[model samples]
Target: MRCEIPILLRCCFCFPLRYGLLVWAYLKQISSISFSTVMIIKLCHDYYRIQASGAVISSLIILLMILDIAFNVLFIISAHKKDYKKMRIFYRYSIAVLCLNVAIVGFCIAMYAYYVYVAPIMIIFIWSFMVPTLVMIIVMVFLQGYLIILVRSEFIKLKNNSQFEFVNHGADEKCTANLDFVKEIPGTV
Candidate 1:
């Protein structure tokens, strides 16, 4: 049998709006702020040696991040309102932002590879960070696909059951779908 804790935690964590907000916070704090600050510091210390226009690229990345944050906030609001059509549109926008982020990460990786193989220049910061960035980007792309699948399944469930009942397991195995005493998310109950 599947562990109840994992299932409960997964269900809670898979709540799309909350997940979007968590991702937004991470991107704002770690990727946009800390990462950019360190890169800027590196550029300032080695302006002549690092000739890859790091400042311009970082600015573009920051702009993309800002767009992503805006999309995520809009998605959270739509989800909260239980407006299916609006949620779908905002989710698509989030997916597009993820695609752009993946592209930017890929470009950064390619630049690192070029510096290593073609240019014979060793930018320590770029080389050091590219690996982790690539891995995270790949994971984010997969997550985007997973979220799409989950949303599609939820749509089907909503269509088949007009009541939109959702079961919440709390210290019990019995399905709560039809239980009047069981509380659930507003739109799904």
Candidate 2:
């Protein structure tokens, strides 16, 4: 049996079931909305650290967060309806989001590298302005990766604990599927 993570909060604080996943989804949705809003507002004010071009970058980040919210909503619906397959869709979506987060962090690091090597900027300016933003994105990427693991654990637990009816996918040579007999007859004979 696959080892399961019982709790989402620091690995040992919360419900032992998929409820942790429900809390995780809600927390992610709220944080994404609030963080995106705060980033937009900050971008508007901090014209030195972030310029008009930063608006486009921040918009792209916001768009990704919005997509995350949509997936969380779908996850909520799936869990409420006990649709484990749809829940698995959210698992796959989380993996994709983690990849996106990694890409964003890589792009940000590359931009910093360009500022350092290709066109040297004031060390103080880059350190004071760009460093914080890069750090924030990197932290988000790590958090996303951690959440992916937590969600995966929950999925594994669900798959293991749940009962499923097994079906034979073989050729119905005797048309056993079509048989609707009035009496219980031995099909083997």
Which candidate gets the maximum TM-score versus the true structure?
2
Going through the candidates in the order shown, the clash numbers are: 0, 0
TM-score result, candidate 2: 0.64
Best by lDDT: 2
- Model 1 quality (TM-score): 0.48
Q: Which segments of model 2 are wrong by more than 4 Å?
A: 1-14, 35-59, 165-189
Q: List, residue by residue over 1-189, the lDDT tens digit for candidate 2.
A: 898645343333546546766777788779878997887787677857776787778878778777877888998887677676877899899788778778877887887887788767555577886778778878878877777777666666566657657777675456536656677666885
Candidate 1 regions with alpha-carbon error over 4 angstroms = 1-59, 119-126, 155-189
> Per-candidate TM vs. native?
0.48, 0.64
Error of 2 at 173 (Å): 20
How well is each residue in 106-177 modelled by candidate 1, as lDDT tens digits?
797778778888666566756667778778888877766556555444434433545657787785766556
lDDT of each: 0.59, 0.74
- Model 1 gets an lDDT of 0.59
**Residue 189 lDDT (model 1):** 50
